[model samples]
Target: MSDLATLGRRIRHFRTAAGLTLEELGREVDVAQSQLSLIENGKREPRLTLLGAIASRLGVTVADLLDESAPSPRAALEIELERAQSAAAYRELGLPEVRATRSMTDEVLRALVGLHRELDRRARLAIATPEEARRANTRQRLRMQQVDNYLPDIEDLAEADVAAAGHGGGALTHRTVSVMAERLGLSIVHVADLPHSARCVLDLENGRIYIPPASIPGGHGLRSLALQAMAHLRLGHGEPADYEDFLRQRQDASYYAAACLMPQGAAVAFLERAKRERDIAIEDFRDAFGVTHEAAALRFTNLATARLDIPVHFVRVAGDGAVVRAYENDGLPLPVDATHATEGQIVCRHWSARRAFARSTRTTEYFQYTDTPAGTFFEATQTGTAESDEFSITLGVPYAQSRWFRGRESGHREVSRCPDLTCCRRPDADVAARWEGRAWASARVHAHIFSPLPQGTYPGVDDRELYDFLESHASAPEE
Candidate 1:
């Protein structure tokens, strides 16, 4: 079906170009002039017979009248203005609608469209300020906990896609991923100048998915990126409605990619065997799936409670000690601000997440038991480098479940009273007394805190550049 707005603009464009006023055209089509005016303004849907008569009078086929693209630059502007005014974002503003009429100049239309776009942009910024983003993330995290971080629908989809690609037991290979893309009718293309803002761009129009020529950094896999791009289409995602929607889509895509890399059936059987042997480990999971340690740890959370009957928590901490991402259903106490957001919040110095940074060994995973106010938990931490930044991935469970995992017998342990301020946040009395007035250090600032969210259909992407890239490669020979 044609977009009514586009159809209306096209009709008006053709009628004006042919030098026929609404009254004249209506008479030729045997319709009232007022109804014809309403149809031209996109206020009314015309019957098929009326459209055919109008097309005959306009000397064009119905197909031409139904073309999706605007008939002219002015028509495009009008269509854009109409869409913006009708959008929920605009309606929420409670502003009076401006109707484009014959008296409105092209310059005036342009100004109106531009103003609405800016207003829309500002509104989005307000909706997702840093604090709002954190709170939204916190809410999302709680929701994940409700389901034990398991998404059966996505898991089922990934299992189907992986099996269709002829994947058997072991790590999913690039060749298999290519087959998966083929099954979805998408071809992967590598380009050196891929946009930095986008991890991968799916060109649905050309049946091509463009990725950067360089190998994905930070222990990420090219298969994972391609699979994620495919997930968006398979999952029927549209432009995210808001920041929360964006976060959910992103997390779901990541979940789908992980599920594809580690098929739930094979992964569950493998984990069950490890459980039988009492030696489950993230490194082993990572090695088995040929995925990053962080990926393996997160995938474990996706299945642990739901399939293995063991609750778990996963946390990624930057070298500087800020929590990058966190999820738990194991009754572990994590530091959270008033908004309940764990991101950017500092992990306790005495906890395994922070203490792992002090380890001298870089080749092996670190294991520890931490006694927190909530309970005693056993944790396994692994350090990895991604995009030149060092970070640690920690997976933990309640002490009772430790018997089923490796590193359960490790003697390393610590006591934490976090949220108490004195546990890890407060300095020693003597140290504080000595440095209270003598020490001064400037804080490093992050510009992203105040920066607006990236602007585009896909956040941060340059739509024009992407379109040009797609056009240049639209007819290129397939690799």
Candidate 2:
């Protein structure tokens, strides 16, 4: 239906529900009865101010009157596919254009939908050029930044689960893990030959979890991994059929795992004590909870936002300057492209995350105070190894909150005017002035460039080879 018709229908419905006649609404909104009638009949479009007045007088929002009913999900998908077919990208993909009509047969529609789905799958599986990946990452980062990296519903559910598990007052332990597994009727089995990338897998059909032996080395890592796997079951997450869903599910699982590892009430109490002591250390938190630095940082953010009422930002960056992961619940300005891609972009060397790599000793924590266009931030960073890659994780808060954190009194400070050419710390000029032609830094190539198609399409894995290996191992004795 036309915009005017939809608006008129909504207005009429609201007016009837409010038991207001045309004259009554007109008088309250200060519009002529004839004009209101004309608008209600779709003969005229109302002005914005007048619409707002009418909506207010009718006890509704202007949007309620203006908004039209959305199309069905499947129909919306069809519309999107049609639009894609008309785009240069789809045309370049060699997919035929699909047009829809009321008289089209069900078989034809199904065929068109199937063809579009196949083309989309192929496009995703195709090796994305660096430029393509960058563009996609930019879009993803923008969507994430717009929300300030908070997922309230998931956090609420996680906190509720923590309370239900009676873990509200203490650090999580193996006993808690065993109790949870038993409560859920899940069997945990250690597998020495699990894939390096796979931490733990949930076999829902068998009510069992298969985890690598390394995950169980007496620290809370084993419990964390088990909880991570159980998150999929507890949250009722299903097999993700798309990349976006896969990322979301993984994030949810990670959040749930963190929540289990650091129960909200206990974590908040710990932070309160740390804040009072003015010694907020990520490592201290990590050691206390038997979690990784990344997990500790994430849990800190959660507490900062949900409990302590402090805004914070956390980032994990690889040696090559690619952002592996990031989260912010504050107005910290991040270096991003027009598309807001945070990953795979070279961060400014002046930022604490990048500066952390310059430390002479990789094990020691590095702290810095940086002044940016947004605000001054106090950051603490440390390096850790993930698989074969070395990365620096930085946790930062606004300068106002720095007094409550450790390393705030550090004298190592820098001024950064990033995403602009005039920034004092220009990598080229500053580095060149320092080293001239003597200092040489070798660039490291990452496996991500040529690794398997992400979202679990093993790029070069032969199905036959995989099947044969599995068959050969089927009767092998378990550890």
Candidate 3:
């Protein structure tokens, strides 16, 4: 669907270029001048026949009037200014709307648009304060736990889409993914100049999904990116209204992508068989689905409790032992701040996620039983490289449930009195005493802590850059 405002602007532009008044055009098109004026002002949408008539009189085609790109730089600024002024944030200011007229210079329009952009950016940034984000994360995590992290609706959708693409099981192919997109009237365009802040840009106007030409490093593949992009459309997502909405949409897309990569029906069947043999393992699951260990670990938690009646916990820890991501409903005591956000929190040093980093071998999964304040958990941690970062993926369950999984017989064990000042946080008495008076160490601060969320229509994306990319490719021949 065309943006009614932009379409109206285009019509007005063409009519003025042809040296015709609204009255003149209306008469030529056999429409009332008042109705034509309403269309020109973007107050009303014109019927198709009337639109065709208007286009014909203006010496332009329907396509020309409906083009997604701005007809001119001035026109683009006008449109942006109008949109910004009409926004809820702007309206809440209780200031009079400034109409862009012939007297308004392009510079003034640009300044107004820039000011609105900044105002909107700051508004969004304020909503994403560290405290708010942490709370939102905690809330989202709690909700996921309530549902056992299973999205049956999304699972059904993925199953249907995969079946429509002729998938017969095993790893989904790039060709099959393309087929899925094509069936939905979307084209997957691999471009070298994808927006730096975005994993993939979905050009709804052009019906194109732009992704990086090269495969993404780590477990992040182009197929996954493409599927995630398509998931937005499949899931009926719109511009997020707030930080919580943004997080939910992202979570949904990622979950949908994982579902596509490993369809629920097939994956559950495979897991059931493995459980029957008392040989359920992450590595085997990873190999079976041709996914990374992290993907397999995360996916296992999605189904473990829901389908197999076995509760589980999953965590990805950075080399420095900070929790990157975590999910659990199995009573595993994950490290969290006051906000209950697990990310960036330091995991217990004795836990398998952190301990796996000390191992000399990355060839096999490291299994360990960790005794924590909450309870004992049997975990299988695997170290892997994502670009330059070496992280560990840990999947674990309560000690009682460990019998259903492989590596339950591993003898490695450790104890963690986490959340206690004496556990791992305090240095050894002799070492602390010697270093306290003589040692000086600089702390490495994470800049992200101080930075605001990215400023754009989409979080962490440059709207202008995305628009420019779409414009440049709008008329290009489809590959």
Candidate 4:
């Protein structure tokens, strides 16, 4: 939603607010006054270092600079710039100043700009290509259905109930988002209260996003947070919601990383390859350029989905020790019936990122929507256990799209992967095979996220089902 003009305007407004002139701010950011002027006018965009310099000069967070929510009337120009930016990459080379936009320098810029353009363009078209959008739409519909399944019942729980069941010594409440945020080389902090206080807490470190522990007793906290995520998406670009803010947190981290990995000029040339390749998921692109997984994932997500015709999902899990981290779903019900997915178990949740998923054992399988019940995610309160608040995402992807999570693709190269390389995996760069009593007969194994425990899974009334059913029966609510 943000563009050069938005950055430029924010720079100007903040510079004025900070009581400094463009020349003065440019001096602080170590850029020439004219260059800063060009950037501020939306004719040029600044790199992270420059943006940081500008933010520092303006006395604001870079995240704050990227914050396009509630666009001022002045922000409209930036939106126009974004559109032009799309065409520049797809058609022209976009260096308005360089009449020869397609020159080498222009090619470089277009590569970087191209993905955004593709992502943007696709989202706008009434047509949903049979590619990733079709896949994404399927997932979105399923998730939304799951969300709908649980939304009306939100009134049933109390914030206190959720919080009481929530895990953590409030570490995430205090801990900043270390991985994606810091990797982008931004200066940020974790705050007890957020820009939208009483709604959720925020960590400005790395990227600007809010994290609310579902532990707030009385269920008010989780409900409020859910409302915010839904509202954020509903408002679309330049509006606020907990989900996009969360996305902003990741996207900011991912986008900046993408720029650094493939500078605008260099990436345009890369686009020509995209036409030749299937979809450039993070890993594939990383292979093209040899980058880190996190970096690739971040970049893929930040890429404008509309331009790339790629869909990225904002998948997250909060487990550490105890309740791990809390998750609040806005549109859909929380997956995994009880606790939120934790960091340690991402591989179990998503198979593509880890090596484990390819080894098909009876333990791993896809649960159909018909089998999973209406609610996809289950929020819960736990006590007397470390994993009390910890939960897993529901594995109920319909038979149609369940294969994407497998580490090996059975079919075509995707233009993009939802949740942006969203196959959950262990935080560790590499992983080994270990069995968890949990993956069923193939048995639940603790493997990396990219590796699903070797199977698409089969549904049968096994002893494990009997056990789970028995457990649920024992715990089932009273009439």
Candidate 5:
């Protein structure tokens, strides 16, 4: 490849590997998006100042460019690019151009800066050594060991947030919370079945929120809301406090935010009635939350239980590679199964096996003509029939946003745990279609482990909950 091509490829590769989007990285380096694109595409090299800015933001050193070697002309080109970047010639080499800019009034900038500082301070409080994560996980496991029946109190937490946020207002405005979530790519929500005491995973740069699943309102909002709260921290806008305090006091802050985005009182009441009636009407949730049909389905799965006393269990692996929201029951198949995934699709090939966790064996190998895919599927840990209320509910959140649930350089060993042997084969359309039924299928092919492709796309969750949440707030006169 040409030197420019190599240079651009490397920059783009490294930047993405660091987990930043073009926009987020642009903000950090104080460069415009188009200009950054040009540099990454090898159209122009960046100046020394620009290179320093980029490097500092991404937490890397100049040597990282040359660490990987090439033995030919390409090698010479890479050296040149590295030289130009190190000497800071690109800033002056690339023709300077002025562009239209968003008019961030000085007042707004000041307010934003102040808010960023507060977030920074709070994030600092949650920071601990790397070892702390293991310790925290252990602590949490011990706490939950005996508390499978544990459920948290949402109303109490909301009340606490109202009291502590000090930005006191009347009832929560869902709109505000939804807007915040949208900006940060969070999954704003309410959930049920958590052991008390909200928690967060914080690093020097960002934080992630995790409320006890039970404490939230619906059993279904787990992944979305936790994800949204984490976005607030990672994207630099969340108000941080002790995990306990944030959960209790900020629940209302989020509630207020959501209420503003969605109709609160009416939606709550209607949903309450749905729960009382054990009824699920798609239109009702869609209109209430202002979310898509898929999101609405997921949300109602949670809301239905609260409104009617139907119980739904939620488990979400929110990363990019696998099951985004893996809802399960030790019991019967849930009543919903709609997938944009197709027959002979091997989309998860390059991702971790976890991607297909909680997959229906019927879908292990998809069937246009058959009703299921082949895989080591779950047995009903509990029993209930689809026609009866005794059946446990299940839903696989193969949402679009989950395309990013990739594995890191690690976890190679973990891939072996997946029993979908067919998923491990080098995927060919014909191979994929026939693997399950073929008489010679390799039994040793039981587990396939793979890491995520580098520089992968992670389209953040725009959230289905928001729209339905809004829809729930609005009322339609009898048509």
Candidate 6:
């Protein structure tokens, strides 16, 4: 069917669903009944203004009327091609406009389909700028919360694999590489130049895992990276074909690696033992597991609620107060904009995640008590430097759960009304009392807030760049 027919059918369906007759809808949209009947019967295409009016009257979007999902696959492809060709970029490329027609040849349709596919792929692979990365992180954070930071199927598979490997007793050591390699029948290769930001890569076809020489010197980091690669094999995860799939696959692999390093049952037992001492020290946990503090804190979030019976929140923030990563099982309110809180937003200065940056020693731990709209929370935070960038990591519990943590005894405390101008921690009062007029700090331009990805593309991407990317990576190896 033609686009007009598909749109007309949708309009009719929604009009009937709203219990509106042709005359009634015409009256609501200020159009004649005869014209509405002509449009609904596909005899005439409605103007944009008329279409919008009809959609509003029917309580639907114009896009809903044109939704390609309701049409046949070929029709949907044609509709997509029509939409793509309308873009200025496609016109600039001097690409031929492919119209939707019932008698269009299969060869022509196939060519159009290939062009559309290439354009889409390019949009997906374009390099993300810093702002784009931040926005993507923000969206991914919200998505993670929607699923409650749990993937039961992946977790079950990891747990079963760990049990099978019989490497569950003590902290995961460098020896795990040998054991897993022997058990899974895989080869491990270390190279000097793998890829930037890539800890390890798995060649599924050859059953070889490649690691960077730099990451191997750090025993814990190496073990974690290697185990994460092993996870792809153990859990039977295929190579990710898209950006979203890549993120999900990485997360699953990371979770699997953590599970392997700190098996669920053993981790729970350790937390139970720590609870008896009323002091849950992330550094101690890290020492016990030969993992980084951040890794230990993330592991704590995984088992805190189920095993320790304490809901917790974890955040990692950069020195500049930007949230790098965050997760929470507890209902403790973290400062968020219209979207769910993730990376990119500048956290309130009153929060421990930001306050920890002010400590005299970067290595020292800092603690604070805060009261948010949700409830009071006690947070323990510590700072570390990696490659010249300082980051702060925080682990917080509800006020009631604070008693079970070592940081609970700290004298530091503050009440926060964050994301508000009149927040108690704001220096507005002090400045007003003294040098309000003499001092002025220009409002910092938040480029990330305005640098969102273009519509119909992944977060922080331009359509043209995406098209180019897709064209280049079309035949890239799965690994």
lDDT of 5: 0.38
Q: Candidate 5, which segments miss by more than 4 Å at Cα?
A: 1-265, 272-279, 292-302, 313-321, 325-479
What is candidate 6's lDDT per residue for 29-103, written digit by digit as tens?
A: 888999888787556888888888888888989888877464455555555666677777678888687666769
Residue 339's lDDT in candidate 6: 45
In the range 196-266, model 5's lDDT, one tens digit per residue, is 22332212222122244445343224434543454345334443333333333343334332333223334
Tell me each candidate's TM-score: 0.79, 0.65, 0.77, 0.24, 0.27, 0.65
* Per-model root-mean-square deviation over C-alphas: 5.0, 12.2, 6.2, 23.9, 22.6, 13.5
lDDT of each: 0.88, 0.72, 0.88, 0.37, 0.38, 0.73
Residue lDDT tens for model 4, 270-357 = 5435534533333455455445433334333333232333333323333322112222222222233122332242222322221222
**Candidate 4: Cα lDDT at 11:** 73
What is candidate 2's lDDT per residue for 90-136, written digit by digit as tens? 77868566556557766677677777667666655664655555565
Encode model 3's per-residue lDDT on 1-479: one tens digit a residue.
25877888888899999999988888899989999888877789889888888888788899898888777899888888888888887888899999999998888888998998788767875767667877987899999999999999999999999999999988888888889899888988888887677878888887888888755432348888889999999999998878888889999999999999999999999999999988899999988887878888888988999999999999999888888899999988888888888899998899999899898888999999999998899999999888898899999999999888899999999999988979999889998887886977899877887877655667778878878878888899877
Is candidate 4 or 6 superior in lDDT?
6
Output the lDDT of residue 390, model 3. 86
Candidate 3 C-alpha error for residue 431, in Å: 2.6
What's the lDDT for residue 476 in model 1? 82
Candidates 3 and 6 compared: the better one by TM-score is: 3
- TM-score of candidate 3 versus the correct structure, residues matched by position: 0.77
Model 2 pairs whose backbones collide: 138-341
Q: Which pairs in model 1 have colliding backbones?
A: 218-386
Clashes of 4: 88
- Which lDDT value does model 6 have at 423? 77
Reference-based lDDT, residue 170, model 6 = 74
